[model samples]
Target chain A: LAKTTQPISMDSYEGQEVNITCSHNNIATNDYITWYQQFPSQGPRFIIQGYKTKVTNEVASLFIPADRKSSTLSLPRVSLSDTAVYYCLVGGLSSGSARQLTFGSGTQLTVLP
Target chain B: SAVISQKPSRDICQRGTSLTIQCQVDSQVTMMFWYRQQPGQSLTLIATANQGSEATYESGFVIDKFPISRPNLTFSTLTVSNMSPEDSSIYLCSVYGTGLNTEAFFGQGTRLTVV
Candidate 1:
């Protein structure tokens, strides 16, 4: 598992597009980039994941560069309901039964009305 | 995705008492995880629970303080011992889906407040 770095906080108005970047300079070949969102007093919810290139899901889109050293989570048309902390996790796909997650400080996305 | 049901959504406990939190999944899962999140803090994994095997504890967490049990594929328990104000936090259980790289799901979380 490699360490990840993300912005401490971000602010965006409702209906805006927000992009949060995560840097994992030491990422390994087996490592995959995953994103999770968490609200106060609740467990984190998986948003999206990508190994390379781009992967989009219902909630968010994940973009990985060719080097795979860093990735970005793009949240389109943000809303007040999307205000929460976003986490970027770097871990191997074959880590076995337990995909034990290591969380960084995370990027706090505040969606203003 | 797996659905996890955690018992005792929230509890207020005494300093010397213990509270056991139960995590039951709707379907069989190979691995179960326990995590703790303090107020306005990010989640920290406590241990990994596997059926028929002893839980694997993480750094800064010990068996006596946070004992875990996974009796079968679908159920696990985490006990917080000798509670204190510092132990007040949310405990969550998570499990990976059937395939590798599959999304992981979590319980709503158990809010524990020790006075």
Candidate 2:
């Protein structure tokens, strides 16, 4: 599993855009970048995933540079409800041969009022 | 996407006792995993439940302590035996999505408080 490094905490106000970056210098060729959001007392929810470049979904966007050493999760129009822990994981996606997902100390995003 | 339901959403258990957490998935999945999240800590993979065979546990976790059972493709159970106060944490069940480049889904998690 590729080790990831992220900020311990970030603060932002409502309607602002929040960007959290994760560095995975040992990322493998088959590894994919995935981000998850975890609210208190609930399971972590999948936000976005990408192998390279950019990928966007209904909730957020993932931007991976050409080097693939790091990736950023961009959340638009932040709200109080967006206050949660954001985790970035890098792992292979091959069925039956994929590596286990190892979570690092995630970024705690506090969306202030 | 897969929907997972975990039983005993929250429980307060006595030390030296055991508690079993059940995980049920809406659809059949090939990969089912168990994770432990200590308070104010990141999630740690406990084991991978393999159907029809013994589970594959992660380092620092053992079957005697966290035995896992995957009787079928869509259901599994984890037993925390001889619990201690140190075992207090949220236990989550996860399943890999069906296709390639997909995301894994997680259960609401079972919060266990050891007293």
| CA error at residue B6 for candidate 1, angstroms | 0.6
DockQ, Cα level, model 2? 0.68
Error of 2 at B99 (Å): 0.8
Question: What are the per-model DockQ values?
Answer: 0.62, 0.68
- State the weakest 10-residue window (summed lDDT) of model 1 chain B: B96-105
Candidate 2 segments whose C-alpha is farther than 4 A from its true place:
A96-99
TM-score of each: 0.96, 0.97
Say which docking band candidate 2 falls in: medium
The per-residue C-alpha lDDT of model 1 at residue B80 equals: 98
Model 1 C-alpha lDDT per residue in residues A1-113, reported as the tens digit of each score = 79999999999999999999999999988888999999887778999988999999888889999999999999999999999999999987844455788888899999999
